[model samples]
Target: MSTTTAPASATVADAGYGSARRRDPVLIGLWISLVLVAVVWIAPFVFIVFTSLKTTGDVMTTGAFTPPATVHYQNYENAWARGDFSTTFTNSVIITFIKVPLGLFISAMAAYALARMRIIWGKLILLIILFGTMIPFQVMLAPIFTVVNSFGLIDTYPGIILPYLAFGVPYQVFILHGFFSVIPRELSEAARIDGASDITIFRRIFLPASIPVLAALLILDFVNTWNEFAMALVILQDAGMWTLPLGLMSFQGQFSNDYGQLNAAIVMTVLPATIVYLIFQRYFVSGLMSGAVKG
Candidate 1:
């Protein structure tokens, strides 16, 4: 009887092992696919870095995939100097600094009111704001230009910053509205019971709790303002006011199509945002996940 029971247990164990073996192929295949996709995505970035480090002749002759015999560190220096990137970098930083904080503050405040207030036309107000997002930016460009020019804002920092704020507000409001809606009403009520004013309640309760959403918004707004070229190009006509993207374009033209210098300029332009994302990667992921879960 003992011998018979041992054989039956061995048979059960063999069946379980067989089942796991069958599933292993599928799991292995999925892992391989993910790795391949990552490699494909990373390949272009690697190529760009290599191109940025090559000499002009090497960049033109060796192709983007080929490694140069000696890495040319001077390409970066030349690109920075020739592009006048220092001034352009300052301009970009100034615009981003103003745009991000103002955009987030206004949007968050508006969203809070829309989400928490018991106004009769709350849905209609939200609808209008959401509708603004659907309007193509190109359609508003002419009107915006006319308005900015009329205000004597054209070719000025305020000119570009004003339009960016207007365009960015709708999306910012939309995102913050969603976040504000899901925050517990009890928290606000508790603050009110403690004799806190509306502003205090927002500052002490909502703002602290909404950090994940705010962090996500900050990253989004920064990247958008940093990479914005079209509005900057149209609004800032002076070379002195050019941002990094426009400055890089000017640098390319000045270099007589030097590929190494162009690539180097591109790398410089990309580096700040890349570093920012890397530094905040964990917070970004957390924010995104938190927003998704709450939504």
Candidate 2:
């Protein structure tokens, strides 16, 4: 049978109409808003990178927002050497590695007990722990200092790591509790039936299932411990024990600050944290979404 198709002009008109009809104003507005927010969020980092690349003279003459005539890559090397970052970076790494694993392990155990086992005043205990997280660390700084001094741990790694564990545990417990509570009770019961101890079950079953949430917790706690300044400043008096944040402060001086070197240090300081977040971001998002759902 012979067939007749619509004219080219008619087909073109229909395609245009369909395209226009599918365009939603709300979605367009949302995209525009996101772009704007991204620009605002990213502007400071861009400015910092540009400033890091410029010579001190260019920065004073042209301003921070302007692109550099030539990228001054040596600023990073200079900053690292001048700031004594090698020592600070090592201290930060040691503290983070020790504290993050220990803190996560402790918090996970507490969360599992509260979430899966029958215990007296478990809710009350959990509530108290949550309250600990809510209290500002600054309020306890003086007392913490006194206690650390009493133990003669001042200017030592233990002084900082101990406090990080104390402050970090409560929040980690809170987050892990939410994720753990939503896990199927039947899984644990089946493991129990098969002769698995609580620790064994936690190690084998729960830990595997909890990877996403654990990754999220790791990122959060790592960033917090790594970037923590006030506590490190107060607890660590020795130059040998200073963390990256404290070391960065050394770049600033009374008469003249090395803006170029300082900005380079800032970029280096942020790089590790940024890389960590990027690595775990997928798991972090999924963990957050799962935690938000009602158990």
Candidate 3:
């Protein structure tokens, strides 16, 4: 006499149910913590956008916590004009467009050389570049300013751009070099055997394969260049030549106490960087980590 066994379907269902029942408390706590953290990060931006729509008087009297009685759509338009964002935005556009491609190409080439080429003292050169990243930009301000002034580049687009390019290169090289190292050397040898030069191999083979890392660099560098204030403020003395960040100081005046206007200007000022990040954010994350993990 033998006992009957449960059906396979029933056994599977019971196992699944048991497994599902054993949820980890730590994971649940982590998810809860993440939600709280997300809320904490997002709350200020929500407040800024809502507060930006309120009238200046409403901001002063009703307070930042209070919602606007009427949505002031004109605040943005007024802020745009008063902030001189039209000129400043053009300057930002010019700087970003010129510097991003230039910086990315230069960094990629340098990274490719350091990663693949058998150069004399290559490690020493890489060490120098890495060391550059560790030094504070503020610390170099004096020397950078002196060089810019001596070259008579101050208050010009190139003046701000040169410094940004110089600062940007080492970081981009560091990241791109990591990605380049993981690439198969066989590919370069194959291309070389096919009579491809170093530049052609880099342009055709390496550059195409390194899009993720490049995209990450572009997004990061764009944000850094856009929001950069201290250097721009120091280098750009002419109001007409100011970038958006520098132009934002116009919102603060001796007589005007318009928090709403200032907040609206801030919203406009941050909008481009926000849109860029949101659009490329996925690439930004994946590309940043692509170099870290190797097969």
Per-prediction TM-score, please? Answer: 0.89, 0.90, 0.91
How would you order the candidates by TM-score, starting with the best?
3, 2, 1
TM-score of 3: 0.91
Clashing pairs in 2: none
Best candidate according to TM-score: 3
Error of 3 at 210 (Å): 1.2
Better of 2 and 3 by TM-score: 3
lDDT of each prediction vs. the true structure? 0.85, 0.88, 0.87
- Tens-digit per-residue lDDT, 201-239, candidate 3: 999999999898888888889899888989998999998
Per-residue lDDT of 59-119 in model 2, one digit per residue for the tens? 8888668889999998899988888899999999999999999999999899999888888
Which pairs, if any, clash in model 3?
none
Q: Give the TM-score of candidate 2.
A: 0.90
Global CA lDDT of candidate 1, please? 0.85
| Stretches of model 2 off by over 4 angstroms after superposition | 1-23, 254-256
**Any idea what lDDT model 3 has?**
0.87
